[model samples]
Target: MTVIQWYPGHMAKAIRQVKENLKLVDIVLELVDARLPESSRNPQLEEILQNKLTIRVLTKADLADPKLNREWVDFYEAEGQPAIAINSNQGSLKAIENKIKSVMADKLLKRQEKGIINQRIKVMCIGIPNVGKSTLLNHLVKKNIAQTGNKPGVTKSQQWLKAGKTLQLLDTPGILWPKFEDPIVGKKLALTGAIKDTLYAKDDVALYALEYFVDNHPEKLKERYHLTDDEINDTTVNLLLNLTKKMGFKDDYDRASERLIFDIRKGKLGRYTLDFVPSSENDEA
Candidate 1:
């Protein structure tokens, strides 16, 4: 088991910033990867922002299994947390706006009863790096206000972006936990590009994904790579080699593995999720 770890100085500082800025926002827009919701969410978030109302967002819904997306939303809603799925790249953010309005209705109503006019809703968007926080921001603002890239740790600082008259957005760099208790969490994070590739072997990560597909999404794996039943049943390494050869990748397993991972990231292998069932059916904040 690879013990993947990455906690840069900036991330520590980001955590401190969350504490410092928690009170400034009326709600926390906690964005998490749709493909790996359980692993992408920082375990420390609920404890850290317990005093604030949070709306859990399942981001990159376009790249995850649609059924799992609904299931996750149901799970969070069952837990009493408001949840929604979005495809930021496709500008699917109207529901988030509606959700924000729904959650803040009572608060805004109270202000109106006190004769406060033109109430504004402030939200802080937080999540692990590369989970599309910036993309989501751009979707909501409909303008390129935040820097977005294909890798983790892109947003290195905090900035406030105004989204029209009544809603304000606080964009912060993604914060990940210091360490992963379960190695599988690390693998899932790596698979979803939450942790930087510099910290782990790309080939190994790709192999891990292939193994997961073999067990949980065999049809997808077979369909994408045209793997025979024998190949599917073979050892993972051997299956990878066979796939590499069939795809005319030459003798380069690493390149083939990279392509496999890239295809999965692009949803070429179909919409899949890496999260397992929650250990308990009980609701968690």
Candidate 2:
């Protein structure tokens, strides 16, 4: 598979902008996709956000495997950090609000002690594009205050908005690093819409997706398209061929591949986690 990399001019600007404004916010909400938490995370986060309180917000929890979601949360918390999983759904939003409040409790207490009660908590939301930063912002405020789109680079600039009377949120453009040293990171990012579609080969991505399910969620393939054991265990190319035939695409493997990707993204196939969430034994070691 060919290596995939996409770093737009705006993303570079966003990196600088985030650093410039890092000290202004009380906390940094580092949003990432729940499926591939490590891959979706910006590796430069610690460098840009030095000495800043960062709360990892794993967005799109509804699209990810729930068991793995819990594991990933435990993994992050094991490092003495706060991690939260949320989606653009009911019940989860309230949980997100509570998490933000919980993290801000100490700062809020300080404000109260200084005779400044009801101070608005300032938060800077940063993450790779299309990981639901805008969605989270809108949910927190209960309105479409920021633009929302499926594609990346949607939020080109930063905008501040109020989430209730006590919280002020700064939504910044999704920033990706300059390069992806590991090709798998690019593939994972591309598979989850973190990377632009034009940069990667969809056939290869679809093949990887197929291999992932074959190894981890073979039953999902059976439930989605009813593939037999042979077809499930076939080579990536053959699997795509089988899918093409089953979907009546005949020789249109590209369309079939795109369809599979769409189904995976939209949860029509099944909930999946692209990365491994380590077990307790691995964590303790």
Candidate 3:
């Protein structure tokens, strides 16, 4: 289960469908995982949505480090992009609505000046699977308009939900990039549950995720699992097995590893965000 490969023909068809439907959308709300915003973004999306007003919304903010999430917001804002960090379940909708309106303010004004008042700004929600697109939709409309599940790829088709007076959301099925050029991006996405777990083995993905945390945020693992940094040696499986043994799981390293993976995905490992930008020096190394 090394780096689960999920190249589905339907993804390409979905891309085509998005292109066909883009004409109907006034703005694009790109949903990204707050923990893995850089990796979860579909690279081709910018190209397909060229010239469209795009607002970047980082979802699941409660599960990510507040400092890092603010850094991401600042980074995007500096680049002339509107970004908001919102925990959808907590009724944080004003920030998202403000950003959308800010981006579409001119367009809305133009319509008003032309006597076409009360036109709803149509927004298409797009993102990789399990990035909380559906959750945000439900939070905005205050209803379960789109089907949602803990697993990835739950929303198979597009649906529209009218959100209040001036906004209507077109929910699209989560789409992945055609090719994950960066292996680290793929691994981070898989580790965070943005990609389907069944596509890869639990132990292997957990090892990769462990290595990532150990290398980037070793203190988080030490603090949460009560394991010394040295204990997180290169052999993640063995480290997890030992930790599980101490945590009261006897003679079940495999089961313990599965639980460890689930804990990481569920933010039990701590509020950590993977790198927002790839380090070129790392890639070269």
Best prediction by TM-score: 2
Give a tens-digit lDDT track for model 1, residues 1-285.
Answer: 465576889999999999999989999999989899888999989799986888989899988889989989998998899999888687455667789889888988898899998767889999999999998898778899899998999999999998766678999998988888987788788777788877777678777898999999999988888888889999988888898898798788878877887888778888888885474554462
Candidates ranked, most accurate by lDDT first: 1, 2, 3
TM-score of candidate 2 on Cα atoms, chains taken together: 0.94
TM-score of 1: 0.93
Query: Which residue pairs clash within candidate 3?
Result: none
Cα RMSDs, all models: 2.8, 2.0, 2.7
Show where candidate 2 strays beyond 4 Å: 91-93, 279-285
Clashes of each: 0, 0, 0
Cα-lDDT of candidate 2: 0.85
lDDT of the structure predicted as candidate 1:
0.86
Q: How much is the lDDT of residue 196 in candidate 3?
A: 78
TM-score against native, each model: 0.93, 0.94, 0.89
lDDT of candidate 3 over 120-214, digit per residue (tens): 88899999889888888998898988888877888888888998787888999899875678777777787788777666566666677778788
Better of 1 and 2 by lDDT: 1
